[model samples]
Structure formats: structure tokens, C-alpha cells
Target chain A: AQSVTQLDSQVPVFEEAPVELRCNYSSSVSVYLFWYVQYPNQGLQLLLKYLSGSTLVKGINGFEAEFNKSQTSFHLRKPSVHISDTAEYFCAVTLKGGGNKLTFGTGTQLKVEL
Target chain B: GAGVSQSPSNKVTEKGKDVELRCDPISGHTALYWYRQSLGQGLEFLIYFQGNSAPDKSGLPSDRFSAERTGGSVSTLTIQRTQQEDSAVYLCASSHNSYGVEQYFGPGTRLTVT
Candidate 1:
């Protein structure tokens, strides 16, 4: 069995400020990690994923995340955030079992103020 | 649909009413997923369909919620005796069964139960 945990429910930052959204997961086996962003009244958009190889992953909109195996963390980071970056972000995981089952974090809302 | 498409885009119903939401996945995509996002919440997995095989519905909240796929092309999710708690944005996504590929999401159906 596996589970996903989002450490923060909301994050607020001024424009151009750096921001980070924390996520963690626990699994008994190998897993795939994903980050998705949802704008107001819109659907989720893929931000980035950590399937294999690179631990430091880059995504759209100048966002990035680092997968820490030891910490069981996949935290998203942005060096400089903009007001348009305000949205709800989700973290998800998929394992080999459960027939491609995906487990999602509760969610973290990012608010970037100008 | 060139992308994952879900309808009706918005639905308003009273408690105890039954509602059916539909989804059309991307062409040739072998994997389809349904998720729901409540206000100020993250995405919750509901079910998954792959090819013509039986769906993985382990994430279904209860027996009152059910879904089906037809001709391996489209899907319909039915919620019986809808409750106010069922009001949320239902999202659908599709991707090839291949690994390392990201899922493409639909705009989603917003259901408001009065």
C-alpha cells in the first residue's frame, strides 16, 4: 500500500518571490510521481513528473521539482513566481500494482499576489 | 476529441437526483481516468479504464457511484441520489498505456447539487 501527503494546504507569495510546495509519498515498491496544476475554473495541467533517471525535473512555466528518495519528497519550486501562477496544485503517484492505480494528495493552493 | 472531453461542462441538480457525466478520451489512447476536485481540495481518483478490459474502480467512494465504458471509446459516470457533498468538478484524462507519458486532461464537468 502507498499514500501521498501534501504538507501545505495553501501557500501565498508576492510576485517575483520564490515559492515551494511540499509533497511526500510512501510506497513499498517503485512508483511514478507527477505534479499537476489547476487554474480557476479549469482542469489540471501537467507540470512535471519524476518517472526515472533525473531527480531534478523541470516543467512548464519555469517550475521545477526535485525528487528525494531518502526523504520521500517531491517538492515543487519556482525561483520567481508570478500572479498568473496562482492555482491549486496536486501531487500524484502511481505504482505497478492496483493496475495503474493513482493516488493523489489532498492539494495545495498557491496564491501569488502582485 | 483531439483531447480528453467531458460533458456537460456544468450541471445543476437537486439532492436525490441522479446525474450522468460523459467523457471522450483521445484517439487511440488506451488509458482513461476519472477524478473529482471539491472546492479548495485536491483531485480524488474515482476510476480508470484501459482498452476493453474491466475497469479499476477501487477508488469509487461508494456503491451509489458507478461508471461504464462503451465500445472502448467513451465513458459515462453515474451518481445516484446525489448529495451536496457530490458537488465538485469532475475531471477526465487520457493517455497511452505506455510509460513515461503524461496524461492529457479535459476541461471537466462542474456539478452543483442543491
Candidate 2:
């Protein structure tokens, strides 16, 4: 079985400040990692994914994540954030060849303070 | 392009009643998935359908939850004997395939059990 854990339930950062949302996973087999964003009363939208090759993965809206095998983590980062970046972010993982099913985390709420 | 769509954005039902949620996947997509989202718990996979094949129901929390995809384009999730614990936002998503594809999500139906 595969599982995903998000370390912080919420992270507050000033607008234009750097932010990092941590995510960890537990799985013995090969896996794929993904990040999603959810705004107020909206559905989740794909942010980024790490399938293979490059460890640093860039996503939409100036977000990125790094897949670290040694650390067993896929932490999302943003060099600079805007007020509109405040949202709930989810980290997910799935066993290789598991198709499209995802094991999601409890989510990290990015609260952008003006 | 049109994205995945779900019907009945909100639902209020009495305990013991059955409710059915609908999903219309993106055209030409071959995989559809159902998930649950609540206040604390992020997103939990409920079921997944691939083309016309049997669905993967391993993630379903209970037998009360069941889903079906017809004509390979749409899906319906039926919750039997609605319990207060079943209250959550039911989300529907679709992807081209399971091979690490990004799943597009719908607005989700918020089900409230009374």
C-alpha cells in the first residue's frame, strides 16, 4: 500500500516571500508524485508531477517540487508567492503502473499574508 | 476544451436515503475516478474506471459506496444508506490514461447528510 503525508497543515508566508510545503511518502515500489492546488470552493487543479528523470519539477503558476529519493520526499517550493497563491495544496503518490489512482495527503494550506 | 463536469453541486439528504452523483468525463478520456474530500481529510480515492473494464474499488471505504461507468464516457456514484459520516465533497475526475496522466477534476458535489 502507498501513502502520502504532508508535514505542515498550514504555512503562512508574506507576499513575495519564498515558501516551501513538505510532502513525504511511504512505498517500497516505484512511484509517481504529484501536487494539486485547490482554491476557495473550487475543484483541485494539477500543479506538477515527478515521473522520472529530472528531480526538479516545475509546475504552473510559478510553483515547483523536487523529488528526493534519498530523503523519500517530494517537497513543493516557490521562490516568490503572491496574494493569490493562498490555497490548499495536496501532495499525492501512486505506485508505478497503478494507473491514475492517487494517494493524497491531508493537505497544506498556504496562507499568503499581505 | 471542456473539462470534467459533475451534477448537483450540492445535496442535502436524510439518513438512510440513497443519493446518486453524476460525472461527465472529458471527451476522449479513457479513465475516470471518484474521490472524497472533507474538512480535515484531504482527498481520498473512492474508485477508478478504465475504459469499459471492471472498476478498481479498492479505495472505497465501505460497501455502501459503489460506482459505474457507462458507454465509457460518464460515471455515476451511488451511496446507499447515507450516514452522517458520509458527508463530504464528492469529486469526479478523468484522465487520458492511468500511465502517470494528470487527472482533471470537477467542481465536486458537496453532500450533506441530515
Candidate 3:
């Protein structure tokens, strides 16, 4: 079975500050990684994904992530965040050929303050 | 184009009652999935439907939980004899295919069992 682990339950940062949300996964086979953000009273929106090729994958809203095969991690990072970036972020994983069912992590709440 | 949509954004039902949550995936999407988000479980995949393939019920918690996708577009997650434990947000997502692709999410249906 595959699983995702998000070490940080909550991360507080000031506006325009950099932010990083750490994510680790346990999977025996190759897997696809993804980052999703869920704002207050809204559905989850895709932030970025790492499928193949480049280890550095960029996503919408100026967010990006690096897929480290050796470390089994896909950490989300943003050079600078805005107040609107405050949301709960989730890291997910799915086996390469194991269908599209996603194994999600316990989300990390990113609280951006002014 | 419109994204995935779920009905009855909020549902309040009494314990022991039954509830049905609906999900309308993006048109032409070949894969649909159901997930539950709760304080205890976080986010967990409950079921998945891909075209005419057999639906994946392996993630379902118990027999009381069931889901079906009709015409490969709309899906319904039925929870029979709901319990407080079932009080959570039921989210639906859809993807173009069952492979390594982005899955769009719906706003989710918040079910509260009193």
C-alpha cells in the first residue's frame, strides 16, 4: 500500500515571505506526486504535479515542487506567498499503473498573515 | 469549461438515516472518484469509476457505503444508516483518463449526521 506523510500540520508565514510544505511518501513502485490546495469553503485546486521527466515541476500561482526520488519526497515551495495563498495544502501519491485512486496526506494548513 | 460539481453542498441528516451525495464530473471525463474528508481520517479515497471498468470499492470503509456512476458521468455515494463517524465532506473528482493525469475536484458535499 502507498501512503503520504506531511510532517507539518500547520505553517504560519507573513505575506511576501517564502514558504515550503514538506511531503514524503512510502511506495515500493514508481508513483505520481501532486500538490493540491483547498481554500476556505472551496473545493481543492491543483497546485502542481510531478509525473515524469524533470524533477522540478512548476504549478499555478507561482508554486513549485521538486520530486526527489532518492529521498522519496515531493516538497511544495513558493518564493513568496500572498494573503490569498492561505489554505490547506495536501500532498498526494498514486502508483504509476495503480489506477487513479489517490492516497492523500494529512493536509498542512498554510496561514498567511499580514 | 465548467469543472466538477457536487449537489447539496451541505447535508444534515439524523443518525441511522440514509443520505445520498451526488457528483457530476466534467463532461467527457473517463474517470471519476469519491473521497471522504474528516477530522479523524483526513482525506481518504472511497471509490472510483473508470469508463466501463469495474468500480473500485476496495477503499470503502464498510458495507454501508456504496457508490455508482451512471452513464459514466454522474456518480452518487450512498451512505446507509449513517453514523456520526460518517459526518464529513464527501469530495468527487474526475480525470480525462485513469492514467497519470490531473484529476479535477468538486466543491464537495458536507454531510453532518446528528
Candidate 4:
């Protein structure tokens, strides 16, 4: 069984400020990690993914995440945010060779305030 | 090129009634997935279908939830005897046959059971 945990339920940051959303996962086997964002009344969009190559993966909208295998963490970060960045962020994981059935975190709501 | 699309953007049904939600995957995608997103409850995997192999229903909450993919393209998720708890957004995603691919998502169908 695999599971993902997002420590923060909501993160409120001012415009132009940096932000980081924490995520951790527990899996018996190797896994692939991903970050997705959902705007109000819209479906989720892929932010970034860590398949196997480098630990630091850059994503759309100035977002990036580093895969820390030893710590079992894949935290999303952004240098600065805008009001448009206000959305729900989700961290997900899937087994390496088992199947693509992703296990997602509870989600972290990113509220960008002016 | 059209992305994954879901029909009946919103559905309101009475409790104990059965409802069906539809999903049309990308034209060449061979992997499809169904997920449920409830208020504050992030994304929960419901089922997964990959290239004609037996579907992995491990994530389905209960027997009341069932899904079928016709011709490995379009999918229908049926909920029998819907409950208020079943009210949520049902999301569909599809991806290429390769492993660890990013899955494209649809807007999702919001179901309100009263």
C-alpha cells in the first residue's frame, strides 16, 4: 500500500512572496511523484513530475519540487507568487512498475493575498 | 486536439437513485483513471484501466461504485443507490501507454445528491 501526506492544509502568502508546500509519501516499492494544481471550478493541471532522473524538477508557473528519497519528501516551491496562483495544490505518487493507480494527498490550498 | 472531456458538468440526483457519469479519454491514450474529489478531501482514486488488461479496482470505496471502459476509449462510472456522501466531483484522466506519464484530466462532473 502507498500513501501521501501533505502537512499543510492551507498556506496563505502575500503576493511576490515565496511559498513552499510540503509533501511526504510512504511506499514499499519505488515510486513516481507528481504535483498538480486546481483552479476554482476547474480540473487539475500538472505542475511537475519526478520519474527517475534528477531530484530537482521544474514545473509550470514558476514552480519546482525536489524529490528527497531518503526523507520520502517531494516539496513544491515557488520563488514568488501572484494572485493568479491562488489554487489547490496536490501531491501524488504511484508505484514504479506495479501500476499507475496514483495515491494523492489531502491537498494544500494556496491562498495568495495582495 | 481536444483534451479529455467529461459530460454532464453538473448532476443533481435524489438519494437512493442511481447515476452514471461519462468520460472520453484522449484519442490515442491507452491508460484511463477515475477519481473522486470531495470538499476538503482532495483526490481519491476510484479505479484504473490500462490497455485492455483487467482494471485495478482497488481504490473503489465500495461495491456501490463501479466503472467500465468501452473499447478502451470512453468510460462510464455508475453509482448505485447514491447517498449524500456520494456528492462530489468525479474526475477522469488519461495518459499514454508509457510508464510514469503525466495524465491529462477533464473538468469533472459535480454530483449533488440530495
Candidate 5:
């Protein structure tokens, strides 16, 4: 079975500061990785995904993540964050050739302060 | 275009009662999925439906949980004899038929079993 682990349960940062949310996964087979953000009272929105090709994948709102095959980690990063970036971020994984059902990590709440 | 939509954004029901959550996927999406988000469990896949294929019920927690997709568009997740443990946000997502496509999520239905 595949699983995702997010080491940080909550991350606090000041506005305009850099942020990184770490994610690790355990899967014997190859997998696809994704990052999603859920704002208050809203559905989750896809931040970025690492399917194939480049290890460095950039996503919306100036966020990005790197898929490190060696460490089995896909960490989300943003050079600078805004107060609007405050939300719960989730890392997910699914088998490459298997079904599309996603295995999600315990989300990391990003609280951006002024 | 409109994104995935879920009905009854919030539901309050008593224990032992039954509840139904609805999900309307984006038009032309061939895959739909149901997931549950709770403080204890984070996020977990519950069921999956793809075009004409057998729905994957492997992720369902128990027999009391069931889901069905009609006309390959709308889906309903039925929880019978709900318990306090069933109080959580039920999220729905949809994706295109192609491999490695992103799954768009809906604003989840928050269920509170008293």
C-alpha cells in the first residue's frame, strides 16, 4: 500500500518570508505526487503535481515542489508568502500504473502572519 | 467553466440516522472519487468510479458506507446508521480519462452527527 507523510503539522511564517512544507511517501512501485491547498470554507485546489519529466515542477501562486526520487520526498516551497497563503496544504500520492485513488498525508496548516 | 460541486455544504444528523451526500463532477470528466476528511483521519479515499468500470469500494471503512455514480456524472455517497465517528467533511473530485491528470475537488459537505 502507498502512504504519504507530512512531518509538519503546522508551519508559522511572517508575510514575505520563505516557506517550505516537507512531504515524504512510502511506495514500492512508482507513483505520482501532488500538492493541494485548502482554504477556509473552500474545496481543495491543486497547487502542483510531479508526474514525469523535470524534477522541479512549478505551480500556481508562485509555489513549487521538487520530486526527489532518491529520498522519496516531494517538498513544497515558496520564495515568499502572503497572508492569503494561509491554508491547509496536503501532499498526496497515487500508484503510477495502478488505480487513481489517492493516498493523502495528514495536512500541514500554513499560518501566515503579518 | 464551473468546477466540481457538492450539495448541502453542511449536514447535521443524529446518530443512527442516515445521510446522503451528493457530488456533481465537471462535465466530460470520466473519473470521480469520494474522500473523507476528519480531524482524526486527515483525508482518506472512500470510493472511486471510472467510466463503466467496477467502482472501487476497497477504501470504504465499513458496509454502512456505499456510493453510486449515475450517468457517469453525479454521485451520491450514502452513510447508513451514521455514528459520531462519521462526522467529517466528505469531499468529491473528478478528473479526465487520461493518465496522470489532476483531480479537481469540490467544496466538501461537512457532516456532523450528534
Candidate 6:
């Protein structure tokens, strides 16, 4: 079984400040990790993904995440956020050879304030 | 290019009634997925379809929830005897292939069971 855990339920940060949303996963086999963002009244959008490449993955909207295999973590980070960056972020994982079924975390609400 | 689209953006139904949510994937996408999002449950995988392979129903909560994809392009998720717990945003996503590719999402159908 595969599971994902998002450490922060809510993260409040001011505009132009750095932000990091923590995520951790538990899987018996190798897995692919992803971060998605969802704005109010909208569906989720892919932020970044770590398939079989470098540990650090950059995504849309100037967001990036580093895959830490030993720590079983893939945390999303942004050097500086904007007011429009306020949204809910989710960490998800899919196991290798397990098809495309994604196990998502509870989610972290990123509230970027001015 | 137009992204994934879901019909009946908002659906309000009685507790015992049935509701059908629809999803139209991108033209060349070969994989489609269904997910549910709610305040209590952040995001959950409901089901997935890939080409002509058997649909993965592992993530579906119960037998009351069922989905089908026709012509490998459009999908319909049917909820029988809906309950208050079934109230959530039903999201649909599509990808060119299921091999760790980025899935594009639709706006989602907000189902409110009263």
C-alpha cells in the first residue's frame, strides 16, 4: 500500500516571503512523486513531479521540490510567493509498476497574504 | 488547446437520489481518472481508466460509487443513493499516458447532497 502525508494543514506566509510545504510518503516499492496546486473553485494543477530524474524538480509558477529518498519526503518550496499564490497544495505518490493510481495526501492550504 | 471539461459544474440532489457526473478528456489522451475532494477528505482517487484495460476501482469508497468510460474519451461517474457524505467536488483528469505523466484536470463538478 502507498500513502502520503502532508505535514502542514495550513501555512500562512506574507507576500515575497519564502514558503515550504512539507510532504512525506510511505511506500513499499519505488514511487513517483508529485505536487499539485488548487485555487479556489478550481481543479488541481500539476506543480512539479519527480519521476526518475534528479532529486530537485522545478515546476510551474516558479515552484520547486526536492525528493529526499532517505527521508521519504518531497517538500515543495518557493523562494518568494505572491498574493496570487494562495491555494491548496497536495502531495501525491504513485508506485512503480502499479499503474497510474495516485495516492494523495490530506493537503496543505497555503495562504499568501499581502 | 482546450483542457479537460466536466459537465454540470454544480449538482444539488436529494439524499436518496442518483447523480451522474460527466468528464471529457483531451482529444489524444489515453488515460482518464476520477477523484473526489471535500473539506473533510482533501482529495481521494475514485477510479481510473487506461485504454481498454480493466478500470481500477481500488480507491472507490464503496459499491454505491461506480464509473464508466466510453470510447476512451468521455467518462461518467454514477453515484447511487447518494448520502450527505457523498457531497464533494468530483474532479476528472486526463493524461497522454499513465506512465508518470502530468495529468490535466477539469474544473470539477460540485455535488451537494441534501
Top lDDT: which candidate number? 5
**Chain B TM-score, candidates in order:** 0.94, 0.96, 0.98, 0.97, 0.98, 0.98
Candidate 6's C-alpha runs over 4 A off are none
Q: Could you say which candidate leads in DockQ?
A: 3
How would you encode candidate 3's per-residue C-alpha lDDT over B4-84 as one tens digit per residue? 999999999999999999999999999999999999999999999999999999999999999999888899999999999
**Worst window of 10 by summed lDDT in candidate 4 chain B:** B37-46
- Please give, for residues B1-114, the per-residue lDDT of candidate 4 as tens digits: 999999999999999999999999999999999999997566899999999999999889989999999997999999999999999999999999877889999999999999
Q: Which regions of candidate 3 fall more than 4 Å away from where they truly are?
A: none
> Which 10-residue window of candidate 6 chain A scores lowest in summed lDDT?
A94-103
Q: Write the per-residue lDDT of candidate 6 for residues A11-42, one digit (tens) a residue.
A: 99999999999999999999999999999999
Q: Model 5: per-residue lDDT, tens digit, B1-114? A: 999999999999999999999999999999999999999998999999999999999989999999999999999999999999999999999999866789999999999999
For residues A1-114, could you state the per-residue lDDT of candidate 4 as single tens digits? 899999999999999999999999999999999999999999989999999888999999999999999999999999999999999999999898888877899999999999
DockQ of each: 0.65, 0.87, 0.88, 0.84, 0.85, 0.85
**lDDT over C-alpha atoms for residue A19 of model 4:** 98
lDDT of all predictions, in order shown?
A: 0.89, 0.93, 0.94, 0.94, 0.96, 0.93
- Report the candidate with higher DockQ, 1 versus 3: 3
The lowest-lDDT stretch of 10 consecutive residues in candidate 3 chain A is A40-49
lDDT by residue (A1-114, candidate 2, tens digit) is 888999899999999999999999999899999999999889999999999999999999999999999989999999999999999999998788867798999999999999
Supply candidate 2's per-residue lDDT for A77. 97
- The Cα error of candidate 1 at residue B80, in Å, is 1.9
Clashing pairs in 2: none
Q: Model 5 clash pairs? A: none
Question: On a 0 to 100 scale, what is the lDDT of residue A41 in model 6?
Answer: 94
Interface RMSD, in order shown: 2.0, 0.9, 0.6, 0.8, 0.8, 0.8
Return the clash pairs for model 1, or none. Answer: none
In candidate 4, which residue ranges exceed 4 Å CA deviation?
none
